[model samples]
Target: MNAATPLPTASARDTTAFLLDVLIPTAAKGPLMRRPRVEALAERLNLDRRAVTRMQKLEEKYPGGPLLLRLPIRKQAVVLLPEHLHAVLAGSPEPFSPASSEKRGALAHFQPRNVLISTGGERTARRALQEQALDTNSPVHRLASSFLPVVYEEADALLASIGDGDGATTDVLDWDLFITSWLRIIRRVIFGDGARDDNQLTDMLARLRKDANWSALKPQRRKTRDEFLRRVQSRINTAAPGSLASVMRGISEQDPAAPRDQVPQWLFAFDTSGTSAFRALALLSAHDEAAKKAREEIDADTTGGRNLPFLRATVLETVRLWPNTPMILRQTTTEVTWDNGTMPAKCGLLIFAPYFHRDGRRLPQADTFDPGIWLQDDVVDVGAREDWGLVPFSAGPASCPGRHLVLLLTSALLARLLQDTSFTLEGASRLSPSRPLPGSLDNFSLRFSPRPR
Candidate 1:
């Protein structure tokens, strides 16, 4: 059969199940993922596992499917096979556009001109500008020397604030405490040391992001957005020597590339990366071998830069095990031909990462924590080739421009925390190595107590 072959259309019952069990819960979590109540409920219900099982059954019903899901307003295609996923991602910005209608709607609230929501020559220019500023090609960014100390300083403050003055063995830590320190690091790294205490700025962005959760359905908060942008521009104007804002300022300006406009996305992305860092710590606490290896890498790196490869790999593994962006959405810019069938123009494509990441049928170490998979060249650069279907950062040309930089900061922070302390996962019963890790790691409820190693 050619691309026009009749594909398996989801039954009405299954369609409702997909919406309730997958899409609704995901959307409810908020694009910012700030809804703790929803997160806890999803974890207790094991929602991701339910979604995975549903997709698994569908795959069995129609092998190597291009499953047609009937949405209320439009039809969507779910990529069941790895090859189909590869094809859609690889042919992006043309046949398959990453700037899907839904994405444009969500990002428009905060970063309308950001590269993720742009296309054509404008996307190219903006992407090039961002890649240059972020040093996307390098594992350690050009400004790592300046950035490393900021990480260490903030990490130290975090440790000190959480520590008992009496030098007690363990210090209790949770999401609120960790995120407070993490945001400090993010502000300092992205803006400058001057922005270290800018709670008002981040708070404003948070309010805007909440509206963003509703996408275009929510009317634009022009007043709030304008103030947020003004404050962001003020921070950028400082251009402190070591920060990303400084680097962006130094980069040659390109037409239609509004550097300040991209700040919201960076701030937003760093929020998730911060969560990933905490989850990596949780993973380390639960798995002794991985923890030991991570410690060894930390010890071996005497540079104080803390840019350790294994640490980065640990972050990658955490993301793979529990992706922050669960469902990667793409829209067809033009009618596209697939192995099973042809999807009409503007059809949304859904590639649910948890299914592929934890699919035991394909990956032997799927359910286990294995950072070593990322250490391999073939796997690290899988975007250009046929992937094993592990896309924690999303692959291909449209992959995150800040991948290397985010990993660097996150890995450094993780390394700093693990250097002189031992952490025990509190109340994380499902994270042990002896069994399959839970599908949903409720990062909000995740708590850890640090002890002297």
Candidate 2:
């Protein structure tokens, strides 16, 4: 297997032309807010595997560790290999910065003051606060034990919404069902028993989410959030036992004085987790064989198997293939060099996950669905998840703190949904017959309800 293409002068020159000609067209498309636009473009290009097809072509032509591409604005160093991922993301601090995420700024549009967008002591403090909140010993972290029951209720709610399974079917986008369920879960997780059914923040966020300049309008959005923040703070002040807002407030006052803003920012993170889980569910529907195996495992481990390895393996594999966002960025604060390329300070490090996850060298059968690799860990073997760092949840200090919660929630949702019901894909969008991986079925309707006992 090829390690990576050695960066060359000729390829650098060609990379410019390739960016202008081929790759940009494959960039994100569709609505700015309601759903992920990358998934939209992936469907358009028939590459729901998200950047996999684009990166495959780049690898063939460029043959290098990292490709230097000239966009309309500036040159970006797109790193698509594992060593470089370890080098820049996990390896160091001074050189690679989080400002690259601030550059994208979609979610940041609505919440600009987010400690997440910037770096230095502010970002560090924010990250530390989040860690404490989700830490094993934290009272807030104890809510994890309730995931399966929550999923069961949410799943049943979805079934009720879809009508009875007795010859009655409702046609709906698969994302619609998944997100509806996730929103219910997140709402309850945040507000607990007093969770408001009406999610007013959704509309304000929708209006704010666009490709245009967002600074001027961020104030308006913040005003909208102000009321919601008050409501949450009130819940905390009232000391609602077991609400996320209350838990976070408790963590803040007693443990460390994490910003009041931390709770909402952390809440916003559920957007990606929810979306990623939805993607896994969509992919699982397409691959009946994998779903069957997962069902068997679910059947076997009924009592206290909190960690369902099969479903976790399947979710990990799906996330590796199609992360919520294909592009991860880091701005260079100082000069760095590796793999025949020079990354100047203040430039960019665009780490594309789809490319690295499918680098062929790290993961054999890189194009298809395979969970045995993750399952192989229990059976004893070095799999892609461990060896190469499959980073849908990302890695290192900046990695998502709720990664474990997401895995558990996703595993529970898939296991419950697939164990009882079978969904049929309908309409123009359909999964490919051969590969059964994520294909161009982004906008399809699904109809499923619980089976009779």
Candidate 3:
């Protein structure tokens, strides 16, 4: 066979630009949602749009190969092809590992033993515990009955707090209004009703995640991390009935699962889910067709259950449009052979999700509001023959274990909001179905006005 094509390394200037422009801004945006000012700056500068454009230009210059970034100490590969992205993501914990150095440094701030950063027998055991607790194999969680009610009740309270009238007067809903209510729901679902007001738990986690945004550069907040774990342990020990903590009770304490260590990741993931939920509301409010479809789905179901596929798809599209996890990084445990060339073991691979999800060049539906794509069976699976172009949740073995539960809660909340109320976008990020959507949506500034029925 002919020798594989050589991996094209970027110039030193390109490497510096990537770090300064793409990576730093994403980090500055915060690991969790603490940095609203940075979020506003990102949105104002159209940072994501600019980053995607840069990736596209680099890919065009070095077609059909992963672009190599020559850093000071080690090299990393930036994936250009969709097939490559799918393969690398799906082939996790093998030649390709999810526990990249950067990921390890970041997550170790809070969840040192998280499955994403685990290896060998430890990974196997911890993953099983997580999947069992999360109902990872199911489309809807096993505890859906228990979880859906929490969503509906909190959503109802939020609507009531907004203002219950003949629907004539408009009430403005923004991040503070929505997320405050959403976090209460998250705490109730994950920890129990007793922990519903436990803002300190989430706040401690936020501090660790802020330090995590610096990756290994920032010193570990040992005191804060320990206290955060203690708080998480307290909630888990309570195991209040009908909560995810309760579900985790089935696992034995001797399994070396590090169960308390896992809760921070859940808290962190759900924080991003809240952002996606807010953004979904914005998109539904702005795009008429999607809003109509979501409403139809809500109206078609009488049981008030969690089967809002269109609404779920809308959440997927919202993440796809403005990905919560923009940079998906992986480290190779063994040398990886690409179609173009072989990368050495321990090399990092960067899959800039925004580039793949919104590259207008590759995706015809890229720049518009289209949840319909997710309606199809397009999600690439491990060892599957098909390749996926868009990845909102990183696919394969290391995909978000809480995906179903997150979607269930998110879609259910969307259903509740859309059922009795109609909302309109109230800010500069208002989207129109006829036009290409803006690259950066400031979820913090995303405002909605509820109109009369």
Q: Which candidate has the top score in lDDT?
A: 1
Q: Report the C-alpha lDDT of model 3 over 219-243, residue by residue, as the tens digit.
A: 9989988888878887888868878
Report lDDT (CA) for all predictions: 0.82, 0.58, 0.81
RMSD, every candidate, angstroms: 2.3, 5.1, 2.8
Clashing pairs in 1: none
* Candidate 2 residue 118 C-alpha distance from true site, Å: 3.1
What lDDT is reached at residue 257 by model 3? 82
Q: How accurate is candidate 1 locally (lDDT)?
A: 0.82
* TM-score between model 3 and native: 0.93
In candidate 2, list every pair of residues with a backbone clash.
Answer: 5-63, 5-64
TM-score of 1: 0.94
Candidate 2 lDDT by residue in tens digits, 1-453: 222432333255566555543344334332233344554555666653434555666666656656666545654677656767766777434577765643445445544444446567767766776676566223124666554566677767776556455534564535666676777777666656455354664444445554313423334455555665555456556534555555555554323334465665545567556666665665566677876777788788764335677777776776776555455667878766765756666767777676677666666767677767666555312123546756776776666666666666677777666666666544313544375444433532333333432
Listed per model in order, the count of residue pairs whose N, CA or C atoms clash below 3 Å is: 0, 2, 1
- lDDT of candidate 2 at residue 409, scale 0 to 100: 68
Candidates 1 and 2: which is better by lDDT?
1
